[model samples]
Target chain A: MNEHVKPVELRKAFRLVNHGPTVLLSARNGSVDNVMAVAWCCGLDIDPPKLTVVVDTIAHTRSLIESSGVFVVQVPTVAQLELTREVGSRTLYKEPDKLRNSGVSICEMAGHDLPFVEGCSAWLACRLISEPHIQDAYDLFIAEVIAAWADDRVFRDGHWHFETAGPEWRSLHHVAGGHFYAIGEAFPADSNGG
Target chain B: MNEHVKPVELRKAFRLVNHGPTVLLSARNGSVDNVMAVAWCCGLDIDPPKLTVVVDTIAHTRSLIESSGVFVVQVPTVAQLELTREVGSRTLYKEPDKLRNSGVSICEMAGHDLPFVEGCSAWLACRLISEPHIQDAYDLFIAEVIAAWADDRVFRDGHWHFETAGPEWRSLHHVAGGHFYAIGEAFPADSNGG
Candidate 1:
C-alpha cells in the first residue's frame, strides 16, 4: 500500500528510532542501488537528529553509502518480513539490482535522493558524519538525519499510533539469528494524557 | 524470578541489545543506588561487547557509574511498565533510595558487586570503556558487557521466545512520551534455522 511521506521535525527525529525497530539500510550510487537489514542502530543525538548504525566493512552497501554520502533507514513492518530477509542476506555485490531480484518494490522521494522500501512504516534520509575512530574500530557510521517521513497509518502528529493499525502495520524488531518480534500494543504514559 | 547468570562471550554480548529493548540503567555508589530507564542505547563493538548508552551527565546515576566504573543494563518486560516509569522519573538526587521507593526489588549476583532488577527478562553488567569525547559531548557512555543473564521463560538458546510467553513476559520497547510496545511474535530466518 502506498502512503504519503509526512515531514518530521529534526529535533523529534530521535523518536523515530527511540523504540528500537530493525531497519533496512538503502543507498544508491547513480543507477546502482542496494538495501540491507540492520538490527544494530540507535539514536545518538537529538537536536541535529544524529544516529549510529553498524555496517560491516565488507558489505557492498558500505561503499555505496560512503560514495553517495546519503542513505535511508526504513522501519519495516511485519508484512515485509520476507523482503527484509531477502535484502538482508542477498549481497548486492553478486547481484547489482538485488531489490529488483528480491521482488521488493521501492519508491524514491522527490526531495531526497535515497529510495525507501514501499512497505516500511517510516523512513529517515541521512548524511554521513565522519568519525574515523568509530568507523574503523566498530564499523559504525554516525549520520545526521537530513529528512524524515512516516506512514500516517502507523505514525502521525509526532507520535506512533500503532494501536489503530493492523498487525501487519506493527514495526519489526530483530532478535538473534533470523528471529524477529513485531511491535504489539501501545500504552501511553499516564503522565502524558495524550 | 531467579535465573542463572551465564557468562556470555564478550563478542556475542552485542546480541543482547540487537533487538532494541529499552533498558534500565542501574548504578550504585557506596550507600547511594539508582535506576533510570533509557531508550537510547546501541552496541558499539562485538569483540569486547562495547555499548553506547546516554546517561544525562547531571544525573545522580551518571556520577555513581562514572565513579564506580560499573553499571547494569536490565531489560525489563511489559509487566514492569509502572516500575520503569517510576524509576525513570524519580531522580536519586532527590530521593536517595528511589529503587526502594518504587517498590522494585533487586538481587545481587555472586562475584559481581552490582545488583540486577528482579523482574527483568535480560540483564547485562558492564564496565566503562572510557570514551571521554562521546561521554562529554553527547552524554553517552561506552561500556563493555562483562556479564549477561536472561529469564529462560522469555529468552533461551540465544533467541527471544516472546511467542510462547504471556504479554507480561514480553520485553518493553518505548516509542515516545511514555508510550511503549511489547515485543511480539517471532519469525526465524528459514535460511539459517538457528
Candidate 2:
C-alpha cells in the first residue's frame, strides 16, 4: 500500500467524488485487469457508501465488473490527463491487454489484484449491489463502497484540501473532445442570508 | 427571457451537466415555488435527455416535485455561489416562499412558473419518470428533460465553450460547507491509442 493511501471512514466516503471529478474505473477478472475513465458518476449514499456510475453495456470493463462482481473507482488528478483520456478512448476487447501499456499500475490489496492509476487522489473499492433491471436498462450500476482510500496530501480529516494541493494534484472535470477543467480555487459562503 | 438563454438541442442536452456541476433545482405547484441546490446528479440518457438527481425525502423540493410532477435543474455559474448556498441550506417547507427573497428569480416558460437562479448558464425543464421504489429508498428522481436551455454565450453548437466563458460564467463543483471550485480552463488531448 502506498504511504499516502489511508482508509477513509465510510460516512465520509461520499466526499471523495462528491465534487464531481471525472474518475477512472478499474476491474479485475481472473488475471485480466482493465481501466477506463468515466464522468457520469456520483455518490448516492453515506452510511454504506453507495455510488452510482454509468457503464455502457458494450464496454469491456462492464463485462469484467459483471463477471468479477467488483471494481474500483479512482479519482485521477490533472497530472494524469493523457493516461485518463487514453484508457477511456481505447478498448482492449479486440486488443491483447490494456494493463501492459495503459500508463496505469496494479495495486494489490491483501490478495486482491486491484487496478489503480498513478497520480490519482482517491480510491473506492466497490461491490455490485445487484439492481439488474436498472443496470441493463439505464447502464447504471449501483454499488456499495466496501473500502475507501485517499491521498493524505490532498485529502485529510475527511475533506479535500485542493486549494493547498496545487493545480497538478487537483482533480479535473472532463468537458468533451479531450478537453478538461482543473478543479480550481476554493472559497467560503454561508446560505443563511449571511 | 434573458437574451443569453436559448434552447439547446435535446440530444445534446446531456452536455450541460456532463461535466458534473452542482445544480439549483426549482419547482412549483399551485401558488408555491421553491429552489434548492444538489450535487448528486447527472445526465442519465442522451436521446430523450433523461437526468437523475437525488432529492432527499426530507427536502421540501422533493414534495414539490412529487406533487407537481415537474421541476427544473439550473446550472448555476460561479457568480451565484452565495445564493446557491443559501437556497441549499434554507428550508421553504415552513417559510412562505423562497422565490420572493431567495435572491433567485422566476423564469417562467409558457404556462409554468419554474424558479431559476439569475445568471445560471443552463436549464433543464423536466417531468418525473416515476420510480416509486428508488424514490423512497434512495431519494433519487429520474426524469425526462422535456425542454432544455442554455446560455448561448457559454454553450453553443452542441458543445460547452467554457474556455471563453470566463470564471463567473463557468460552472462549479460544490465541496461541503460553503467552499466550491469554479470550473477552470480547458485543454484538448488525443482520444486515440485504441
DockQ of each: 0.53, 0.53
As for candidate 1, its clashing pairs are none
Q: What is the Cα-based TM-score of model 1? A: 0.92
Model 1: per-residue Cα lDDT at residue A170? 78
Q: Give the per-residue lDDT digits (tens) of candidate 1, residues A124-165.
A: 999998877767866878898998988887788888887888
Instruction: Give per-candidate clash totals.
Output: 0, 1
Which runs in model 2 stand beyond 4 Å of their true positions? Answer: A111-113, A189-194, B111-113, B190-194
Q: What's model 2's lDDT at A106?
A: 70
Among these predicted structures, which one has the highest lDDT? Answer: 2
lDDT at residue B25 of model 2 (Cα atoms): 92
Off by over 4 Å in 1: A1-3, A191-194, B1-12, B191-194
Give residue B17's error in model 1 in angstroms.
Answer: 2.3
What TM-score does each model's chain B reach against the true chain B?
A: 0.91, 0.92
iRMSD for every model: 4.4, 4.2
- Can you write out model 2's per-residue Cα lDDT over B1-194, one digit (the tens) per residue? 67878889888888888888999998888877889999998878888989899988888888999999999999988777777877888898767655566677776766556765567899889999988877887787789988888889899887888778776777778877677777765655643212
